[model samples]
Target: MQQAPAKDRIQLVDALRGFALLGIFLANILIFSGWEFLTDAGRAALADASAIDWQHRFHKFFVDGKFYTLFSMLFGAGFALQLERLTQRGADGLRIYRRRVLILLGIGLVHQWLIWDGDILVLYALMGLILPAFHRLSDRALLAWSALLIFAVPIAGVLTVNAAGWPPDAGLLALSERVAVALGAVNPQDGVTWLRRTDFDGWFSWVMSGPIYSWGIRLMSWRIFKVLGIMLLGMWIGRRVASGSLLNDRRLLWRVLAGGLLIGVPANVAYTYGKQWQTDWPSLIGTVPLALAYAAAFALAWPRAQRVLGIFSFPGRMALTNYLTQSIICILVFYGFGLGQVGYWPPAAFYTFALAVFLVQLLLSRWWLRHHAQGPMEALWRRGTYSGRVTRAAAPG
Candidate 1:
């Protein structure tokens, strides 16, 4: 299939991606600034403890799981777009898609290993591998599978674990410890201390060894199912877009927005403040609904706010470059190898910093796209995906 010309590109999707990137950065900055590692006592001692508390609450309610869900959905939607175009042309869609996913996997590995441990690219790449299997399913079947994977699997896992009174598996804990030692830490705390105080080498070790433990925990927690489920939902949305129903149906958008507000908001409130639940499952349950609400709201507003909201499309167009760039910049800003401002800034300061960085990125993206067809990383990814057969066409979101 030929690449979609610029005029045919979906600017709203790009704008939504840009919006998701901003939220992801805000969520990730907690870890990037090293504030996530602070002890209760350490946090209590901060001058802005009350403000930080409020910020954390805000994040739990609005930011934490929501943006990633949106991003995952977007990824799925993009996949649906590619599959539709390729199938129409009778191309080897599966082979090309697998190759594309592998390229993404390679990029994610580099980002995860050398830059930061909070990388989602690796997870997305792995999840993307499974999407092709569901491409031929009916829309109803796709949504059924999505709901089952997103809500049912994670809830069941949580219930099973709670019933069994089990902790994280011992072998996984042992592997984590070994990974710590490989990073020159005597213990987990030592690893944290080393990361904050040591130079580039120490930072490198921490990031390089991170995935072993992180992925292990993620699997044990059934996060993959959640991610895969969200992608499937996105795929359904993509199909809607392809059929011209997504944007044309104002009634559907309104219903989704109403559901998100009535259901999503209250669920997230309980997830954020209800201590009796004693589990994060509420957040998981609420994430998709709220994310859908956000998307619906954005879509409803897009026609009226096209000029203003269109600013986000710049960064959205080159989401990969912007995402990786955020990681690299934040690493230098907070890590010991650069400014070493980790754990020093209050929550407000970090939020401000994140916004400032995003603004810069937005401007840079606008300028870059004016000169080049895509962001540097996007160009590289497209080249790799098409193996030089396609040139100067819009890649999927």
Candidate 2:
């Protein structure tokens, strides 16, 4: 990527943040569409070959898993930046980081149990809590740990799933299957579409149904090892960025960019087809490289794509607020707990709505950042995080 324009400002991170948010919206639309696979009737309803084929191909090959991993990288990098600042000032980095992460966990708990079940906040927060443990590791050690965690856990999981009579065999897999069953039984906010009973009742049911989907399925099937691994990998990348090692090594960056794509594209292709064989192995191995490829590609193209990247930078800067609000809007639009419009739109329509909302958010975020120092949620997080400490004036980012 080009120089960040200022010492403290890293606009490439913001662009990637915007990119990650778009991908997240796209991935979560399946839930907003009220897709259920538990019954023959529900499966039959979703069985339009023309409606699903292209969309499935697009998501499987491109949109699935990759962007979230990118987001994870940003998360780690952000923390690395903050910790460096704290350490330089002789501040208690762990306490400050812990408080901040705990606040994130609190927000995630509410988001997870009260709003939507598809929330990733809790997982990120939980993982953030353990991130500092890696702070002491050297660059090489950190990368090694990341690679070990990312690759090792998934292979172990798949093997366990397959090996009959293996100890703890299918424990995670079986639980995920059971959670899936429960998820399909519970209808989305009493199954209303294009209408509502009452706002109060709608909200009441929405709250009631939150945990059933969130904890029952989302948390149950949570891929802790993989996410943690990615986050750790992100932490290592963050260190590289903070150390200026990555930015200085243009040759290495291009090599990484080329290598990631060369390996990742084909790996994802295998993953797309691997589903037919009932395996997660391909995705477990492929998603990281694909995500790295996307980041490197964007960095390489940033100068040429400045106009588009500039547009994305607005939403990227206010990622936390934009991300949370997306869930709010989707719940209102699709779930019976609000306007009661579940299953009313096609896949493309759902994604289009998400894009339309994000476009509005992009404009609004641009306008908001013009005057305010930060987005609403981010401001609150900072205030809560540094409440008892002396703080500096906001940077002119």
In terms of lDDT, which candidate is strongest?
Answer: 1
Worst 10 residues of 2 by lDDT: 388-397
Q: State the local distance difference test value for candidate 1.
A: 0.82
**Per-model TM-score on C-alpha atoms:** 0.92, 0.85
In candidate 2, stretches whose alpha carbon ends up further than 4 angstroms from where it belongs are: 1-9, 36-48, 164-222, 274-279, 389-397
lDDT for each residue of candidate 2 in 361-396, tens digit (9 for 90 to 100): 999999999999889999998888877634332211
What would the per-residue lDDT of candidate 1 be over residues 1-397, giving only the tens digit for each residue?
A: 2333334348888999999999999999988877777776666666465786697678888897789889999999999977887767767777788889999999999998788876899999999999988988999999999999988888887888778977644356567667767766644664336657655557656776677767766766577898899899899999888767677688999999999888889888887774423137677678789989999999889878988888999999999999999999987888877778787777878889999999999999999999999999999998888775442232344
Model 1 superposed RMSD (Cα): 3.5
Tell me the spans in candidate 1 whose CA falls farther than 4 Å from its real position: 1-9, 167-170, 190-192, 274-279, 388-397
Q: Lowest-scoring 10 consecutive residues by lDDT in candidate 1?
A: 388-397
- Model 2 lDDT at residue 215: 46
